[model samples]
Target: MALYRIADINVEYEPRFDMLRERSKKYLIGPSDKVNFKISIKNDDPSKPGDNNSGLSDAECEYIAVGSSFYKGLISFNGLLLHASAVAYENEAYLFSAPCGTGKSTHTSIWQKHFGKDKAVIINDDKPAIRLVNGIPYVYGTPFSGQFDISENISVKLKAITFLHRSDINTIKPMDGSKAIYSFLNQTIKPSEPELKLKAYKTLDTILNSVPVFEMGCNMDEEAAEVAYKAMKEGICNED
Candidate 1:
């Protein structure tokens, strides 16, 4: 078994699976002071690019198994892996989540453009981790970033969560508590256990209470970002 540092936590891989090394290369550490996650995959064959294997069919299943385990472990420790695009702007993390092909990435790109190419950056395009650190939620970029492979081994203070949907014109509105809770449960790495479910929702409730959530309806354009950001900033700074 080899220990790997992933998502700002120590992970020990059982059976010494090396295929995931590429994704975790930057996280390889000299020695782990602790183990936050564990995975055993010697029996599974991971896919490699251009390799004459059964494509990603087998790899995809393995990924799901590993991912599920990691998610459960994370949630057990007040952390959550959200299915969203996390971007850092003005030293705060903003998340955008939506259904497949709903242009989640496109929306954040506009944010990057609005904040200036150098000022704003996508920390993780998918599967970023949100963990409660000393009562404050922080978002971390993980290795499981989606195909575009856009991610960095970094963490940022989370400011808000935004649910994106396609609409004719750009609009942003504060989400209701019930709607915010459900939307978070639907979009995050959900845990099936009864106790875990309760803890997840409680943590979410606290987060939504402090950090404003918004449902952003907009088209695929730069103005969408401007409108959304303006609404969110004003709302957050002015909230009681």
Candidate 2:
């Protein structure tokens, strides 16, 4: 096993993942700023003793899946098992954390197409990292990209966490912190252990203290990002 760092957090990778090492890389996910994941399992060897194999004992396989999901890059910072689209730009990440067919990926695509080459990076169209450090919320890129390209784990002071909604025009509205916390919590992919719940609450507190959460309703356009950026800037001002 070898350990790698995502932000300030350390993750342990199974030596078995070594076979896919060339295809593997670390990434950050959600607002929690969790560890990188071991993506794309090319081997399902049941007799294997290592973490990357699906052939291990049930308990071992489950444990490896859990650990690797966070450490290998299958999980995101918000704690959700994400299939939604995501990307990062100008040190900030914009995520569409909704269920399938909610236009999350489409929203991300609009940004990429309009934002121009090299101006933006998609941590993962499917998974990104979110974390709060000392009550300052932020997002980071990861390797589990969905529709777009994946970039290195780059942290940005968060502007906002806006849920996606279809609409006639672009608009960003403040979401109740408590409600936002609850919704975001529901998205996480983890065991409902007591300690995990406690940690979740603590993480939510950190996020509330750092960033302004919102409900974004809009057509696929650049205005949404602009509105989000302005709102985040305003929040930053208030904090200052």
TM-score, each model?
A: 0.86, 0.67
Compared with the true structure, model 1 gives a TM-score of 0.86
Q: lDDT per residue, candidate 1, 4-24, as tens digits?
A: 665567877642334345666
Q: Which candidate achieves the best TM-score against the true structure?
A: 1
lDDT of 1 at 193: 89
lDDT of 2 at 67: 38
Candidate 2 is scored at a TM of 0.67
Off by over 4 Å in 1: 14-19, 42-55, 236-240
Task: List the candidate 2 regions with Cα displacement exceeding 4 Å.
Answer: 15-20, 26-86, 146-149, 234-240
